[model samples]
Target: MTADTPAPEGVRLQKALANAGVASRRVVEQYIVEGRIRVNGTTVTELGTRIDPENDLIDVDGTAVQLDVSKRYVMLNKPTGVVSTMRDENGRPDLRRFTKDWDERLYNVGRLDAETSGLLILTNDGDLAHVLAHPSFGVTKVYIARVSGTVTAQTIATLTRGIELEDGPIAADKARLLDASRGESLVELTLHSGRNRIVRRMMAAVGHPVTELVRRQFGPLHLGTLPAGKARELTKIERGALLTLARQDSQASPGPEEHSMQENE
Candidate 1:
């Protein structure tokens, strides 16, 4: 088909591959050109190729591709010292150990550092994952931190005003001193920034090193009382709410201060 031609009936081949969790649409197109994908026992190399997923005999690298229509969404109370990855190359504790009971391939939405722990979502729904992970959606995450220094009001102010990090300037949507001790304190932080090790680095930058960190909430999902290393499928109501949030039209420009990132309970 010509470049200007509209796609034929049924879904595009790459979209089918991505929805089946094989890979992203762009990567799947490459696989088609490389003759790694076959539809009804015939190699499909055209970018405009379309197939009825229900009727097509699709295969990838000689393996039959059975689309998993039953998308699974799981919430895991991640424990400290456990990596948020499907596999750990060093043979260290990873998400696989906790998700051993699940038969479907699941991956964490984002990540929490090995030293940090709390609510984490694992799912095979690539569209939902992409929506939630993308910064444009502005999904807020709340973290509670135990710091080694007296978390003064000035520290909280600094965090709110924005601090220059090694990567760039980042500010928390909200920062509050949960509790304070003689030399240490508990601070609750809320932000939509998904920068690497941001909470730890931000606290350290403000001279209050994070001794312990736990993500209290992600978007509408909360850790609640789920024990560490335990997994549970999202309830029907919870799942519906999450999808609604993901589908909402994001603002034209979602600056850190513009969106409301409230604490969950």
Candidate 2:
């Protein structure tokens, strides 16, 4: 937490890029391979190499990189029908469209699918995004889903007990048939898997096709009453917690030549 403290161990370069808000890990890796990333005034192309994020020097496109310390962290009450993606060449409204009123260049932290609604995080801080999105942290997401058919207690048990999806075996930390009758049930699931359409796939595998889905919570973050289509910056405490979480995880899984960055809101 202080300069005197040693740099985080096992900090992956891509992880630092994500934490910097420059781009996703995949995209950043491509940039690295293309010779766009430099560590301490040297071009870096090796993906396997790691560096200390907090203590190392990372340069992208001739610009020095550091943690996005002042980047704006926001909570958006995403409305249904609005996609959470950054860009869609198909001409659909993406998350960036919602930020036209704000000056900061931002990216969605994790995601809420096009059909899903509720708490969506948008931020310029790349490390926060990286730490939050990384599956290694075992981030728990809570979703409230409405299904077409009544979900029996056995179905809930199956979800909680774990089921096999097309990807592989998956399990929700908890589940309940809040309203098993009338073909309307509130199903809650928590898992670390971040595969696309994971929750929907898991439910469909259990004979409970989702009719409507909304993300209610993500880890220590909440949706509260921000209202549909509204965004609010994270509090100082929230931002600090995010950084602390990243530091903790980085320490736990410290890489050899991790990357880092800085941002202005």
Candidate 3:
């Protein structure tokens, strides 16, 4: 019960970190000695320090490390014409068809309209999902859009400057014209907004309606050569990148209680 006494429960800090894939046990021990690891906000340099992996927050070099081994992160290349929901009330093509292999109930972090197709993350980790899905976290998404008109440099400038929509004003973090020919344009846009049908709307507002839209990247995850309608577990590096992104955002923002108090005032 003394402040100096070690807790009686939980696994050793280095062991937990190693099991979480932070590094090998020996490397984690070195990290501890270097004061690069922290448990529950306190720097933990002792190799024997115990921590409740389920409850304690662990961070390495200021980025959080997810310790829950049961957590699952999956990436899916959703094809066009399939609804984002696992179950659709309208009897339309749904995501369930692509998720049968996962025993754990995984839900999408965000959505792409039925008409659009691209990278989608389905995960059983609620904490990671919340951090990635929430617009306040400012996770950037990349989209490749084919629009029905010639896209000039001026239009790309306008997208980054700002655009007024029905809900409010929005702006792309980055925009570039990939190709413009034969009365059609291929435009790549980077945005942090999670608004519904935002890419399509932005294209229309710019006088070039989107003929086809596909998400190319979400946060640190990219839709590489993964074929459409296929799903796969996130690689070790991919998972680490995602956790780091979530941790960085969560640390930069105020906690819920503090944000709520500010809102009330």
Candidate 4:
């Protein structure tokens, strides 16, 4: 509880910048340490320094930092072969392609692998992003995966029990067979952990290699027939619901597995 204390008059400078859509809190903290941030015309290189957003004049690289109270929350039904990042080094398709016309600076809340596709949230509100992405918050994501082999009830039990990967142990919050009776079958899984390629790894570990995977839901948001590669702004109610979930989850005590997932992610 004593880890961080907000200033009586205002919040941390990095938080202010993050809320204003400058960047993530971690990135804003780096900007603070790198001397790129100035408050009231005075350079500040100390982390956790507080500033009055209403009164203090803040700037980044000499440009006046205007507080953007209007933050954006976007939902993208990402398509396969598109990278989750805003920019890619190899010139591959990225989120910027989908969000190019957006005026607000946005970053992905979590990530979907280039081979995986589905509901992806992009937001300029860094605080909300942190909570959703951070494993400790326990915001569940649901995925429907088509695997190469039939998945049985025993496999579902094993998946729910948990599997040990190189990174850490991952357990599904819930699992069910969506379809079966052929060489390929569909399985639905819900989990809170966000380790890289976790669902693929877990399914492959159970002798069912995933052929296709799509995240159908993230916390309270659902893909709901959203076309692949299309982007849409989150409704105010949807945004509020997600924020409430994140806030409630963050206040709970994190398990050891959650800590491991955080480190690995």
Those runs of model 3 whose alpha carbons end farther than 4 Å from true positions after fitting are: 1-7, 61-63, 254-265
Q: For candidate 4, lDDT tens digit of each residue in 1-265?
A: 3659753667899889888767899999989889998786689998869887766767776555555457688999999999888999999988898888788889998888889999999989876788888776678899999998888999999999988888677789999998986798899999888677888889999999999999999989999979998999977457657755654566567554454333111
lDDT of each: 0.80, 0.72, 0.85, 0.81
RMSD of 3: 5.2
Ranked candidates (lDDT, high to low): 3, 4, 1, 2
Sort by TM-score, best first: 3, 4, 1, 2
Residues 36-77, model 2: lDDT tens digits: 988766799999768876567676765555454556878888
Better of 2 and 3 by lDDT: 3
Q: What is the per-residue lDDT of model 1 for residues 153-225, given as tens digits with 9 covering 90 to 100?
A: 9989999999998778889999999899889999999988767788888999989888899998988898899
How do the residues 200-252 of candidate 3 rate in per-residue lDDT, one tens digit apiece? 88899999999988999999999999999999998877887898888777778
What value does the lDDT take at residue 195 in candidate 1? 72
Pairs of residues clashing in candidate 4: none
Which is the better candidate, 2 or 4, if ranked by TM-score?
4
TM-score of model 3 (CA atoms): 0.88
What RMSD value applies to candidate 2?
Answer: 13.8
Mark the 10 consecutive residues where model 1 has the least summed lDDT.
256-265
In terms of lDDT, which candidate is stronger, 1 or 4? 4
> lDDT value for candidate 4?
0.81
